[model samples]
Target chain A: MANNKQYHVAVVGVTGAVGQKMLGMLEQIDFPVEKLYPLASKRSAGKTVTFKGESVEIIEATPDAFEGVDIALFSAGGSVSKQLAHEAVQRGAVVVDNTSAFRMDPEVPLVVPEVNPEDIQKHKGIIANPNCSTIQMVVALEPIRQKYGLNRVIVSTYQSVSGAGNDAVEELKDQSQALLNGEDPETNILPVKSEPNHYPIAFNALPQIDVFEDNHYTFEEMKMINETKKIMHDSELKVAATCVRLPFFYSHAESIYIEIDGDDISIEDLQNTLKDQPGVVLEDDINNQVYPTPLSAEGKTDVFVGRIRKDLDVANGFHFWVVSDNLLKGAAWNSVQIAQQLIQQPGGLK
Target chain B: MANNKQYHVAVVGVTGAVGQKMLGMLEQIDFPVEKLYPLASKRSAGKTVTFKGESVEIIEATPDAFEGVDIALFSAGGSVSKQLAHEAVQRGAVVVDNTSAFRMDPEVPLVVPEVNPEDIQKHKGIIANPNCSTIQMVVALEPIRQKYGLNRVIVSTYQSVSGAGNDAVEELKDQSQALLNGEDPETNILPVKSEPNHYPIAFNALPQIDVFEDNHYTFEEMKMINETKKIMHDSELKVAATCVRLPFFYSHAESIYIEIDGDDISIEDLQNTLKDQPGVVLEDDINNQVYPTPLSAEGKTDVFVGRIRKDLDVANGFHFWVVSDNLLKGAAWNSVQIAQQLIQQPGGLK
Candidate 1:
């Protein structure tokens, strides 16, 4: 049963935006699979999803669905993950939960494979995926943190609507078309779906990504703040984030300013360090107008980092713009990489 | 002619976006005008621009056009301002320039009436206007800086295409329309009109605004950094900025972080101080999801401040979002205000 020729994998929440992406990610990475089960809520259970050029009927994602599943990817919702992740773990499957349910839990490891693949080894049956905005940022900044000894981070995110969900993506397109036709755009899902009021994301920027916390930071902003500390294993690191939802449908961009512990690190020094990192693509040539836009980063797994320059006043401070596909590197590909790295380690399949 | 009632006024760059808004702002503020002269390039001249319910022909913006003008408001390009602003000034017209030409000139004052009405008195012949993005941020932070003793500032701007010019605005609309029709968006005037590369701004964010300077900061970003110090008269203050061109068409929004010298300043304290400021409207109620977006601040003359919260780690550090119509407060309305504020003062119109 251990390190078998091929493994049975079940995709929970197979009908969701990220869940649907997991199938393609697994195929893109060429994950060895003996059997694939697409699992969703009972309402969406009967639909078939194409995985590796074959239609696989989705089964009910109850506790019993985890039977014989060696790996389970959960993206249904927080409630679904909270209810059924333990059941999958009980059935001898490792769970990669793509929800906020267990992200801050002490028992779970929030894994971004590029930054902390080693943390996956300590996962007690469940590994949490960090938020989309947090994933791309850590991938870019972790190298800098390691080489330069990071001191502080202040990030302002320009996130895409897909980070909200598929419905929000549709809302953006519909709204754009409506506005183009001189009609009022319908607002049903943006900013937050569960929130009472919704705003149009077409040709607009919403400062609130998720709901606002008591401290006035949005839930998305706090996730970037708290998760960076936990993932970087630096409790004393000062971090602040202002997460905003922009009109794009693919990648998330960040304007990140950081203060480093190292002295006199030049832009070339930073670029040379970042270029050596495997997951980061350095696109920082200002003379040629070389930089990454969300459109340029669409559907790409690698994080694009550019606009590297020193702060005008603060000698130790540096700033850059980072962008990546929120769905790919931010969600499904990260989850797939975690699962892939999980099995590569010794005694990885418990 | 000094303090003459209903003085003759000239609108430079009358066919441009900010120029057109200048006409409306002059009317909205009800400035007493004996006659209006709309000036544009020779090609765009001869077109009638309606003002005060009558057609006003746009005269060619020549040196002789300033003959009888008491006050000339320039929004024409920088070269035009450079060539003609002084010509107008020699003809005894006080120039309120909206270009980057004279902003950094020590003799000419960079005035945001809300922040530095007194600086206008130092103007030799022309009073320079700050950049649209800088004008809005300084307006929001000046009151805070005055009350709390400011220390550091970091701003990331989400600017509209209209800040580039009317062609950029049409580029966005045409690109959005093309994108909605499932066609590739045309790119001609975005990021910078004169730059070699053009990227689609439809559903995309471009980190570059204006051309990149020698230090890798965009001209827009350097303007924010340099102008903030000059306007606040605090060269020792730490300021950094990242100016981005978003898909929005009207208002420019900024995510600003500041560290003040005062201790234990609460969000309520900041809000109380900001609300009392005349030009900044406080719209920060997190519980009800009340904050300003680009859409909400469109067509408004006031700078909107919201999402006020203190940083989690830095006791003296705080963050807020500011938005204002880039064409109005950023350019036209501000210029009109300077002119009105000028005429109200004795010995103002020389």
Candidate 2:
């Protein structure tokens, strides 16, 4: 493929939150798209989404929808990806999946460009994007791990409602307004939409993000724990996570504790390593009270790292507060970055 | 000094949030109060606080305010407590101080009645109340520590605005409404009111609760770490905390991880130990989506425990989600419980 040649790009689940974000990010980043296919479920098929100031019709996602597509970004739920991703791959298109369907698949490489750009080259016609929480954590930890060598990690996340999807975002708004008006907020989706019980996410924190696994950990937490290990490629590293949902509309903030293998690493060493890392911005200054909050990191593509400090008792332990736009760096922008990596390979994507 | 005898009680900082809660708890519990003297700073001296459907005129807090008082409940700032607690104690009043002034004092015993009631007997004139975050955590961990023998602990707190005082609570409400209305929320009191820079806590999470100490841990986080050891009487316990202030108004929730000493401790064993403990209500039914949220635990005195699970990798490690009314069990109610224990002593309070 030549640099001047354009590619036919397809955005699957184009009407969903991250799907919509993928479309906007493609336009913002000026991806070389000769033709755009906005694909969705049959219910949302006829809907039109604006791209480059022109309306693009959403077509029903089917196996044949990938006919001439060069890259397909899948942001639909896991089942949709499970059903359509391979078909897209078989049609000679590289699929960058945003769902968790193939994240743990040994055959598919899970890639965060900042942390593991080379993993994109190992994909077998499909690449898996990590979870929103896991993406930001690994991005912040990767530079430190490369410099200091990570031994263990313990993370507690303060996630926003947007990570659940567009409906959860709407539910958060409705519930917040209803509560402000002193009425009971209707809850149809939250914690887990498919689960039997739903909790209100307005002005409250929900401990369970996805449904529980047999081991009593929510699948969301398990995703963070397992995906961090897979992305970092450190199977022996100890990682633990507690993922909670808060009422914010964008960005997820994490309180992370990491133990470095070396005992001589200072806060300055960690800050210096993260300052030069790609897609990461260090915003730590205790005297100025500067640290990243969810709202502060909204609409940003960079993972903001701050509140870096050494643990009082643990000699090699350090703590950090990492925040990033869950939709951008966590999902849409990351998928787009991987697609760009595929495009920028010498002789282009094979 | 007899059990049936009514005692004179002085409620210091009567105009503040926790002080007002103290007055309500005293009335709700029907403590044997012969006369109630509501004492505040000179600025709030004329304000009236309601008690048992009667208005009590607020008097200026002076050393003479404790002339006839058997117990003085102090919820004012630490400076006020440092300046007045000793004076009140010198006037023959048993002071149960709620500020952080004397919590770490070698002579002062920090008491949580449910966890360490015997420590109340050793108070040298003043019994210090532990920080709100520490009180709830120690309450939830005491039963497990006693039965299983604890070795290490780590906690991340989701604290509410009320823990910062009443003005901070009002700021949260104002900031939330302002943000909802598409206006920039004014930040006069949040993260730290006295600090030079303030961050909005409406839809954001602030990692710093109090000012940063020399060790880079915020005063609030340090309090949780230091005070927990003092209350538990275990100097060898490894405790680390990351305290974050959320947008809620009443309850503080904590995600706590602990490593028990015994290898055979199951989730059932931890649950059984906490189920029978006083002031702890176990709400750990995952099937029913039963877990304690700040909204669900508001105005409740008991510490609600849920989401009990064993760590996936660590054999002896377990995790818990604990919630309690920060102003109630964390401050006012804990102080009242200490006073109750003081009265229940065989010879009454010395």
Candidate 3:
């Protein structure tokens, strides 16, 4: 691949929230795309999605859909990725999967380009993207980890409905409108779509994110717990998570507690380190009543951190808040950044 | 007083949300009230409240309004309590102050009947009610602390706007409806009412509960930390808090992490102890997807605990979620219960 040559890019689930954001991120980053394949289920094939003011026809995703496709961004579902990811690879396309398909697979590199760019070079045919909550948290914590060593992490998340899908977003909007009209808000898709129970997210908080595993941790919690260890490349790092779905439309907020290995690191020390990070913006100023909320972080690409303080008892313990748009930085922008970093490698993506 | 004797009660701030709930709680508990005096500010003095189907006239609260009153339940702002609480006590009525004006005072005893009923006997004139978020958490954690000694605590709260006041609840409702109608929601009462800045709480989460202190911890967060230590009677306990206000209407939910002293406590051991707690209901069955949400715990009086699991690492660490109505168990019901317990003392009101 030459630097001047353009690439053919395919976006699976082109009409979904993350997929639509992926198209916007590609254009905003000015990625040179020679062709765009808007891929979706057979039911949606005839429809079209606009890319850079040009309408691209949707293609029904199948084994043959990956022909001549240089890169495929998959966010349809875990089942969609598990089904056609290998098919895309067999047809000479690299899959940047945004599901839980191969995140823990040793052969597949799970990358957050800011934290572990070197790991991207080891991907065989597919690269895994971390969960939305995990992606923002690690980006904020990585700066601290590089300056001081990290010992333990415990996070409680306030997530938005968009992370579930575009349908979940509509469900929240409909529910809000219904409740505002003094009617009952319908619960069709939330907590987990496939699960038996559906809880309303209008003016409510659902503690369960994904289905519960044998250990009683929701799959979403386990993803944060497991993915943080993998992406930081320190399996010995201690992580615990409590993921809750709030009524917000976009951006996920987390209250995180981390114990660093620095002996006498002050709040100023931690602030300076995070302020210098590339993709992170430090919004901390308690005297000025400054901190990031879900509403303030919407449509932003960089991870926003504020509300930093040291634990009253432990000298090394610190607490902070992190927020980022789940659609862009958590899913679409993260996937695009990985692709951008991969192409910039010497000799290009091998 | 004899066992058959009835008491005279004055409901201060009678026009406020908690004051109305306090009247209901007194009736629900069938307290032996000889007379009910509904007291409020000059603006709300003409308003009337329903007690046992009777329209009780609201009296303007003043230093002299406590005459002939045996018990006073105060829920107005801290300034109101500071101005008139001693005046009420000087008028010979015992005050159960709900504001933070007297919680940390050495002479005033902070009591959560389930956690520290014994502290009620140490009060000179005023019995202080703990913060709403702290009350529910202490009830759930007290049982665990008894069976498996405790070491440290870290909490992130999803508090309701109702905890602020009736006006904040109206702000959330109006803002939510406005946004549903495709208009920008108004922001004037959230994050903090008196603070210079107000953030929208509809369809979003606000990280600041009350005003920030000099230490960068919000007043609500500091209340949780200091009040827990005072109520638990353990100054050496390590506690940290991050309080966040959400768009919910009635209940406050807390994600709490505690490091206990038990050597080999299994999940069931912790569950059994919490189930047997006097004022707590255990709702921790992940297989059936049974956990308490704000919507489910709206009108309930008991603290609902669920999602109990041992930390993946740290054999002595455990985490759980607790929810209870901010008005009922958090304020009104707790105050009424304390008054009931105070009368049950050996010689009645000392």
Candidate 4:
């Protein structure tokens, strides 16, 4: 075994949004790292990112990049992760993947550190980060799930265009300007870019996110459905999602209706559970008009949960609103938490 | 009985969003208007609006201005409508109020022409246009309700800023530009302007649309809950809403979960019913990548319905996505449809 020394960390896809967030979080948390490796595509190889007041040059992400790394954080495209994640795993690096490539794999533990930190111990070499939408949701619901067993979850997401990537953010900007100037707006990246027709996202809501699946659900919707089950490890948990992209640039808001197993769990009890839970920010104050909003939740790492109320007529039903930065808790912060756990948990790096 | 040859139309609050939409709809539908009376507050009384290529001067909306007018479309603030709607009714003008003033009044008929045009005949001098969100939902659901009795409706809305009125649209634009240019964004018009301490909406989602009620539901949500029952004329219908405003300029998207009375009603049946219904554009082709989006629904008059699918395990339960321009279907078009019904239906005119 190695002596008590800081681990050498490598961040793959350091140029992307989630990757950029991963770098920032690493600095914020001051993850004990003797050496830092920032890896991106060949195009971004020469770019420099500051870590611990030291400028580090981004290297081309390749199989050899993880040669001596003890921990690797992956947030690149799924294809890139699929190609290099296993290679890094084989090279004795614990890979915390932030892509869908390994999330559904039985062998890889899909984790929200706050919700299922125990699952992290079962990982062989690679751990998968749950979907951004799924991460915040389970973080908010798991406390309630633990207190009052969850039965069904119906969530509809008001996602920002930023979740689609940085380009969609630009598209929203250009399109909004076009709409304001009375010019014909252009759409090349919304509701699925490869899809034949692109709709103006400037003033519209698109019911479809990601591409269509064999089932009626969009890929984005299915991600929420499947990833929730995997993260919660409850195949029997009834989950349905409608993922819609709004024109906002950051953060995702979810209107979630959840049915619990217990017969008489009051809103007060649920609120108490959330208020005590880690990584959860309770923002439900009706009198002062304080509640979780996507804008207010933006740039915040904690999952903001509010609007906790029992259903009007249903006994075991409750509805709450959840908001978190899709870039943070939804993606980057989650990946970093997994890495932080890797350093602290027993046998995490062995 | 007044002659059908020409109806003297008075447009109340002629400078506002829904008010402007009402005027445009009157022109688009070409209501047989002998004289166009544009009415607003004293501040806008002398302002002129183009009606059929002719500029008509705005008049101070008072009891006297409504005299001899056959139909008056009121889209002013709720308080203004509450104060003057009866006066307009007393002046012999049939009032089609687009505010919440008389919507819950049992004496006034709450009408969505496509859903319940017959209700217009029961109007006691004033007919209430349903809430924009409620208007679109009922328009889409009425067909399904006709086929399969609706037991419960759970809707979480992704509403546009324009639904708050013209000021919100300007605020969104100005705030977004301010954010982009690294300037301090102002927030004086959203989430109830009367509330102290405003939040930015440029890249955010606000869960509260109106003032919070004691029940923890926003006034906007209550409007939806109450309006759905009133417009559907089913006081016992279980309807719940979580109204949210995204930074979109127009259109509202709703993720609606509904339980039908019959177990035999399949997703296909619901799709077919909506596809064939008037004022509904069914866009649910998931396999070929077709579905309704708020962006595509923007500027369109029809309610775009898609993502129709039966709940995975629950029988008689279905989920669908509905999108429509709040400015149009939610406000402008519904008012026009009311005007058209008043002209077309036998004894629709008071």
List of clashing residue pairs for candidate 3: none
List the candidate 4 regions with Cα displacement exceeding 4 Å. A1-4, B1-4
lDDT of 3 by residue, A1-350 (tens): 34876888889999899999999999998898899988999999989899999988999999899999988899999999999999999988888999999999999999999999999899888999899999999999998998798989999999999999988999988988787778998998998898998989988899999999888889999999999999999999999999999998999999999999965888889889999799899999988789999999999999999999889888889999999999998999999998888788898866
Candidate 3, residues B79-165, lDDT tens digits: the string is 999999999999899999999999999999999999899999998889999999999999999988877877899999999999989
Q: Tell how far residue B172 is off in model 1, in angstroms.
A: 1.0
True contacts kept of 4: 0.65
User: Which residue segments of model 1 deviate by more than 4 Å?
Assistant: A1-4, B1-4
Which wins on TM-score, candidate 1 or candidate 2? 1
TM-score of each: 0.99, 0.98, 0.99, 0.96
lDDT of 2 by residue, B1-350 (tens): 35588989999998999999999899889999989989999998888888888888899998888898899999989998999998988888999999999999999999999888888888889999999999999999998888888888889999999999999988987887888888999989988888999889988899899999877789998999899888888888889998898887889999998998877788888889999889999999887788999989999899999999888778899888999999999999999999988998998778
Cα lDDT tens digits for candidate 4, B202-283: 7678888888887788888889888888888788898878888888778888899999887887777888788888899998
Candidate 3: where is the Cα deviation over 4 Å? none
Q: For residues A88-196, could you state the per-residue lDDT of candidate 2 as single tens digits?
A: 9999999999999999999999999989898998888999999999999999999889888998888999999899999998898788778888899998999888899
Q: Is candidate 1 or candidate 3 better by DockQ?
A: 1
- DockQ-based class of model 3: high
Model 4 clash pairs? A132-A330, A204-B294, A204-B295, A205-B294, A205-B295
Q: Ten consecutive residues with minimal summed lDDT in candidate 4 chain A?
A: A1-10
In candidate 2, position A350 carries an lDDT of 74
Clashes of 3: 0
Query: Using DockQ as the measure, what is the rank order of every candidate, best first?
Result: 1, 3, 2, 4
